[model samples]
Target: MDMLPVDRTNAECWQLGTDQITVLTTCAQTSGQIFAVEIRMPPGGGPPVLHRHDPSEVYYVLEGEFTFYVGGEGGVTRHRAGVGDVVPLDGGTPHTVRNESDADAVAFAVHTPGAVMEGFTRAAAVLGAPGARPTMEEVLALADAHGIEMLGPVPAQL
Candidate 1:
């Protein structure tokens, strides 16, 4: 049996947002269904530009409240999640989540088919500086850079 933990710092961790990221699993060694931990907007942290993945995802809230933007949604929805809240996601639709509270918003995400996180980081770097907010154009560029073809223009900002 595999008797070792994957070191997160050694994994391909990257900042997809000014305060968000794709942290590789430190204990799972990419085992099971859990692949990474996505922490978005620390206490008082800002939200990331809207985006989505080609694979399915799950956002299990670990603390604080946040706003969720699911694809085709009429308006933003506010969900106060604590240690036990889970938000499931399918790859078909686009979505973005933001911390609307004064505390950190932690979530664990499982991605089927490992290495997509690495692709996100590489794409982010090519399209925009890591740890920085990306513009709509930049996001489109990043998507293209990562081999994810753009289907339509970015939604108009509210």
Candidate 2:
């Protein structure tokens, strides 16, 4: 990697349904130290499915509101976060993020030790090529192959 900045023009991007993720920094660029992505989440829906992975993640909300449900040893907790709010999720914690608002939301997600989320996104992008939307089962298989486990959608009551 050069000692220069990486903008969207030079970055990889992927679309997951209504959400778009732009890979700002890659594991190859950071030597597996870290990876980051900017996510644009549409209103009324975020990632309805809950998931857990080994790489820890931190999300900094840049716009709009979000509802997060996190599950750990202490049980599940719901968080209502908005612009400027930072949500840190430890490795292996099951979590789901949602946008119950009327407008889109933007957030930055950072993954420690790199390659994890980006790797999944790279493969997932293929599954979505030419707008071929893969089923949840297919996505789960891909996620499982990359050390991620999808724990189904968030409970409706939450």
Highest lDDT, which number?
2
Across 1-158, the per-residue lDDT of candidate 1 in tens digits comes to 44246455555555555566656553245544445666766764543445666667777776676566666556433445677788877775566666767777777766654455456655675555645666888777657665454444335564
Q: After superposition, how far is residue 2 of candidate 1 from its true place, in Å?
A: 4.5
Instruction: Report, for every candidate in turn, its global Cα lDDT versus the true structure.
Output: 0.59, 0.85
Error of 1 at 67 (Å): 2.2
Model 1: runs farther than 4 Å from truth? 1-3, 9-12, 20-22, 26-34, 43-49, 72-78, 125-136, 147-158
Candidate 2 RMSD computed on C-alpha atoms after optimal superposition onto the true structure: 1.7
TM-score per candidate? 0.65, 0.91
Residue pairs of candidate 1 with colliding backbone atoms: 6-26
